[model samples]
Target chain A: MIIDQNKIDETIKIIKANGGHGIQKCVQCGACSAICPGVKAGFPLLCRALIKDLLNGLLEENIENSSSWGCQACNRCTEVCPQGVRPQEVVFAFRRYQANELAFSTSAVTSQMNLYETGHAVFTDPKEARRKVGLPEETPTSAFNEAAQQEIRTLMDNSPMGELGLF
Target chain B: MEQIGLYLGCNIPLKNPDIEQSFRKIFPALDVQPVDLEGAGCCPAWGTAPSFDLNTWCAISSRNITIAEEKNVDIMTGCNSCFGVLSEAKHFLETPATRTAVNNSLAKINREYKGTSDIYHVAHVLHKKIGLTKIRENLKYKLDGLKIAVQTGCHTLWPSDVYKVKEDNPYFPTMLKELCEVTGATVCHYSRLEGCCGMGGMRSTDAEKSLKLFKEKLLSIKEETNADMIVTTCSSCFMQFDMSQPILKGRGVIDFEPIPTFYYTQLLALAMGFDPQQVACISQIDRNPIIAEIQSDTRRIKEGM
Candidate 1:
């Protein structure tokens, strides 16, 4: 594979912009992978591997891999990294690239759609539960307030999520 | 006695209104006022906006914080995922570049990312703001003989840097255990105490894989602690254990009987003399056996005293 230095630089730039500070300082220490439940659960992608690929300008070749989504984003990787590489942030950075520049998972799209439509990512008719618990039949949430839902919709419409046709 | 704005996020209101009700009863009893975070939307969750872009994630999360800012109070959430997203959003907005981009998006809605309010998990508020002394004093009934396992959830412990209140040792956090102990329950030390319950976006992405993680944690809790009840600080973890365990068992993934689960606030509400029907109304798994055990133990303790 052709090693595109410009692609690697662009990827790093986006990662840095998205709170993946100290990512380049990653020392290929497998601590993140060792601690990651995703790796434990048999996912192929590991934080150390992803960082190596990103640094080597190989992210695009592996951009479509589902293993990127395996991250729980538990921040365990961030906690154990000696170099402060914050591998979870790098995972998120790659996810952002996949989601915006390429494609997003159906579940992600549905969740964004839920947020746009109802002002919540997971909306259920909560009135009965609230009333059962002696709370007002209508809890103070966007689900009960049309004006609030509109405000959320407007925000999503103007955000990058909307631009990506996520909603 | 400061009023703290309550951010319900999505799950607590929908899947576990009982936890919300528990907070309602317990917060006032502790002298900490719980204000309704009116018109606040989703934390937009990590699986959604943060997966797409940071600027969008921060903008949406900042909007929610701005609502709390307008109320002039710090925001507290019962869900760890909401805590994680909102706290990270606050941290993101602290940087000029990210804040400017987020503000640029917010400008469309006539809003700005003002770093005025801090986000807190409810457990932090109980430990820091409410104080263990107050909690102990208000306990009308002690969980004297109850052996409880605690799940602090992944979000509450990790990324401790952005969080305003953190466990003294984030790796082996004591805040949840300490809070559980104040209810007079013996907090058990489990091998997998810090493992993820796998109830986040991962569950939706791959249910089988998610259940594998939950099964491992649950089995470890059962084997290591063998506690009567499991208490958690996060609503998602509550669902994973209380809601998912039976299904996993039925699917033949595990053979152990499902353990009863409680959000720490619900346990507090019950220990503070509220009826179980009042605070813990909606549990997927049967809690009657555990509740009966607690009541019987309380009576025995009362007789001894």
Candidate 2:
């Protein structure tokens, strides 16, 4: 599944506009790669390499099966990034672009997509959910009751962020 | 006190009710109210859409926001995963570009998020509006003898701009420990206070890797702090600690209780003299030591008299 080089370009523009800097300032010091908690633990993380690939249009071939998905999004790279290019966000943005272009995204990504389709993420079968997750026979009324009485909810509704929807 | 609709996703209400009871007991004193927002389901977090289809996620998350708006109060969450998803959704609808796309998509459901209300975790409520002084004033039982390791769950700290606080370091356990200190507990300083639990998304995909990463941190706490309990502000982290610690022990990772993972609010309630059963729901755990410790404390206080 070759991602259009143009799609990668568009996501970079989106990420930069979203306040991510140093996307283009990469010196490829391997700082992001070396300091990455995932990379050090025998996980596949070409974080610095991936950013360079995207910038140089070298990601089209292996875009789908790339190891970028291994990123935990912990932003260790963002913290260590000498050039300020957030490899974490860049990789995510790239994945998002390529995922959109493909017919089938990764299983994890698709499962989450199914969540909105059914209002539940894990179980597609309703009866299975009840049997396995121990969902009650009722409509989970008590759970909502407890939620309604929590103090933080009231404070949240009343905050400025709550008002602006950035909460 | 004004009551806002509360959205207790999954873990807090069923798996961990101690925190729920604590919020019930304490918030009234803080002049804040909790409202019941019905028909609300999971915000889904990483479970929502890795595909990044903005419209579906917005509609589902906005549907949740709309429930709170309908109740005419803001939605509050105890789970960091819930807070992250709801907060991010709110951010999406507020931005002009994302808002337009989401609004155009959600037109099918007749639901639109006005970006009207805020979503908050309980820690923010205690530290901000409810102030430590007020909580300290109400404490009848001091946490003097208990050594607590405050675990600030990942979502509670990340994307720092959204969940702002007075911490010198976002990874620092200051806000949480300060709350514990107000109740007279000693907050042990530990390495990796800001480290990931590695359980959030990985639990569903790679349980072994997730448990392995989590076990390392759990063992570190026992070696570093020798603390009685591990306290946290997120439900996922709580579940990971409470369940993973014991399971990892069987796997030869550690040989301890994994320190009881109490919600910060529950610990506050315990310090305020709330009974363990009232403040801590027993059904949530497979261990008895947490309740046993509180009962023993009650006996000691009785004997002193």
Candidate 3:
């Protein structure tokens, strides 16, 4: 990506306006990315790299490729960063940007969409959550005529039962 | 004739029944009447609201508050996440413009919150309203020799500048310690006293982060304090420390004695001479030693022959 001084300046200006501090305090150390639980889970993202890209005007609105949903929002880096930069908050801000500005969605939205289609998030209400945990059949929904979607709902609800069943 | 609205959230009715049971057992002695609010759902912690989505959070939180206001009592929560959400709404409504915005948003839900109710964590009810001094008078048992490490959970302490008190010092592990002291237990000091538990951030969706945080905290508890057990007032924190800690140990991230996690009420009840069974024994995450220890102590005391 070609570096654009104007774009970098604009991004910095906007982020700072939104209460993001420590932009200039980054010393190129990768501690924020290293300590991030997201990167540990196969997300090719690093805070230092993002900062460098932002400084070089190569920042993209879509961060879906960067393990954005992988963030646990733990703020460990914010606590441990020597430069006092809050990369955790930055990642959150990026998520906001993606959701609000870039219009990117997360995998979590699939379950939410499934819920919107059905009265309950899962196909089977199971009446009691405990029954749902025990792998009961999902309550059939007239919303989506697909039996597979209903089964998916049942399976999702039953997934937590692994703990109940000692799996 | 003190009254408080009960916001049970979802866990008590479905998954964890003992919390509500314990609350009912203990509240009457302290003059607290917990009224039930029907039609309440999850607070949606991070689901319905972003950090800046204060308006949505207020509407959801206010629905419960409105229910409490109808009963004309302060709102008391059995779940820590519910307490945090309701408290945040209450805190936001304390401001005029924010109150107006929240009330305006609730028009969709056909509810208007007047900001009349006070939301409190169960710990606040027991430690603040009931006052430990008075609770101490009811003790049927004494945990005089037990060493406890109080795990003050994240949401309870975060935004510490606003939510936390100097006396409690979430950053220093004092409030929980003080509560334990009322029951006559020695508090073990440990590092990371003010840190967030990894469980708070949708750890249900992502387990590794929760596991990492739990592992680190378990190691800290073992290395820093010679505590016989770890206790917390938050249900999620209890679940993480008690349940996730063992999973992490199984993963071999840390090797230490799996300290049992107890709810603040359970600890208080145990010290007050309620049998561990009455405190709801088997549901605990790391259940082995604490129950055994209490059982052996009770047996020893009974067999005076």
Each model's TM-score?
Answer: 0.95, 0.77, 0.71
For B1-305, candidate 3 gives per-residue lDDT tens digits of: 68887776544444544555566667776678877665454453443233323444555567657766777777777676766666656765777876786666566446678767777778777777888778877665566678888887755654333342324444465667788887667888777665546665446546665566666667778888868888887877777777776676677766765777788877665555555554555363656566566444552332222
Scored by CA lDDT, what does every candidate get?
Answer: 0.84, 0.62, 0.59
Question: What RMSD value applies to candidate 3?
Answer: 8.5
lDDT of 1 at B216: 87
- In angstroms, give how far residue A39 of model 1 lies from its true place: 1.5
Tell me the tens digit of each residue's lDDT in model 1 across B1-305: 78999999999987688899999999999999999988788898888888877877888899898888888999999999999999888887888888888888788777776788888889989999889999988877778778999999988788889889888777688999999998778988978877888887677767888888888889888888888999999888898888788898788877878899999998888888777886887888899887766656434334334
| Per-residue error (Å), model 3, residue B189 | 0.7
Q: Chain A TM-score of model 2 versus the true structure?
A: 0.57
TM-score of chain B, candidates 1 onward in order:
0.95, 0.89, 0.87
Question: Which is better, 2 or 3, measured by TM-score?
Answer: 2
Give candidate 3's error at residue A35 in angstroms: 12
- What does the interface RMSD come to for each candidate? 1.4, 9.1, 10.5
By summed lDDT, the worst window of 10 consecutive residues in model 3 chain A runs over A158-167
Model 2, range B21-136, lDDT digits (tens) per residue?
A: 67777788677887766656667555334334444455567767877786678777888887867776676576787777656544544656677778877887888768988887
